[model samples]
Target: MKNQNFVRNLVGTAILAALVLALQLLLGSLKLGPFNITLTLVPIILGAVLYGPLSAAFLGGLFGFLVCISVISGNDAGGFMLFSQKPVITLALCMIKSTAAGYLSGLVARSLSKKNATLSLFLAAGIAPVVNTGIFILGLLLFFQDTLVLWANGQDKVIDFLLFSILGINFTTEFLVNLVLVPVLARILRNLRFVKQELAV
Candidate 1:
């Protein structure tokens, strides 16, 4: 039984990795209103709730790797030219923020699942963007504070730069997209769970 579960998880993780990569490559950024919505976070959140933290971490790592690819390929949003100047810090910030987001999403879902499974899933889904963006902002401040100042040249303070210039439309759209889509996707998956049980027979 343990081995079977392990195999199931291994297969599931592989599928998810493929799915995330496909989405990242195919539909990574979709422009909606004034925002560019990133679809990669969806798979990370789904893996967290369905599998667990380690699986989520793996997905997050994949997501971050894709981000690096975007940087190198000249498809990144804010530009990663700085990455060429400071490779270690840039890579670490990217990977750490994404990995933490995934890990925390799983942790939050598992902790709340006992009390209320649906709520747990909903909350877990909702927090994905929050965790992703929050960590990103914190990472910028910690690792790129000096460089960020140049970006925020006209702003009175870093907070002003972050909130008004950095996070305004894009992050808001990303958050809303996750809030609405995650729950719906999770619910659909939950409804389809019976099919897996049937397959077990």
Candidate 2:
């Protein structure tokens, strides 16, 4: 079982990491306005629910890596511009928030599922976007408050700036998307005997 666990973790992580990259690169841009509407969060959240926190972290890191590549390769002009201005800090923000969100989602879901799995799934799904956005907003505050304000052009107040410019529809859509997809996908995944075995292992 220990060996099974180790193999399962490795294999599962690889598969999910691939999924994250594929969805982002193959499916074309999911961006709207100043935001990149994310499609990869589903896989990260799924890994968290099915595999474990470590697997989730691995998937999240892969997601970040792909994003980094996308930016560096000049596939995303806005991302590349941001990376040009604040390379290290921007990369850190991307990786840290996503990685933490993935790990936290798995930890929360796994813990809560021991008591109430239905509630656990929703809670876990719901938490990731909040954490993701929260960390992003915090990162802006910590690393780019002046940049943000300058971009906002001093028209909007801080809270209003965050809501309108930052979170806005992208945040709502991401949250709702996760809320709907995570549970539905989890239900499908639950029927898979292999997924169950991996989880149990």
Candidate 3:
């Protein structure tokens, strides 16, 4: 039973990872200002709620790596050159942001499961995007503020362009996407037999 459960979780994680990758690719093509609002974190959130932190983090890291590679290869829709400017730094930030979001989602869900399953899932899904985008914004402010200010074209009044970018665009985009999709996805996943059987306990 133990081995079987492990295998099941592994397979589920792989499938979720692929789904995240596909979503990222598709969403990357669509631009809504600075936020290319994507459902990429949905799978990671689901994985975290169903499996555990490590699995969730692994899937998040995997997706982040793929995104970094895509950026490096100039496949991103924005063509912002996020990876080209500072490859290692960009990759590290992506990995850290994604993994932390995933891990936290799982931890929060697990802690809240006994009280309210729906609320737990809701929190898990909702928190991931905030964390992911928040970290990205912070990293930009810390490392790439100068470039961001130049790109702002004087429209933003904030001294730190990164801060303005987050408040102005990134947070809104992330909030809108996650708000619309997370609840729906969480409800659907809760109904799945595997999820109910393995995760609801």
lDDT (CA) per prediction: 0.73, 0.79, 0.72
Instruction: Report the Cα lDDT for residue 87, model 1.
Output: 75
Instruction: Please provide, for model 2 over 31-150, each residue's C-alpha lDDT reduced to its tens digit, 9 standing for 90 to 100.
Output: 776557887899898888878888888888878778788877777765676778899888887788888889999999889776777777787788888888899889878777776776
Full ranking by lDDT: 2, 1, 3
Error in Å for residue 91 of model 2: 1.2
lDDT of 2 at 117: 73
Query: CA lDDT of 91 in candidate 2?
Result: 82
Residues 69-142 of candidate 1 have per-residue lDDT tens digits of 87666676453655766778777777877788888888887787767777777777777778888877887777
| Regions of candidate 3 where Cα sits further than 4 Å from its true position | 27-29, 77-80, 159-165, 197-201
User: How do the predictions measure up, each by TM-score?
Assistant: 0.85, 0.89, 0.83
Q: Distance (Å) between predicted and true CA of 148, model 2? A: 1.1
Query: Global lDDT for candidate 3?
Result: 0.72
Query: Candidate 3: how large is its RMSD?
Result: 3.0
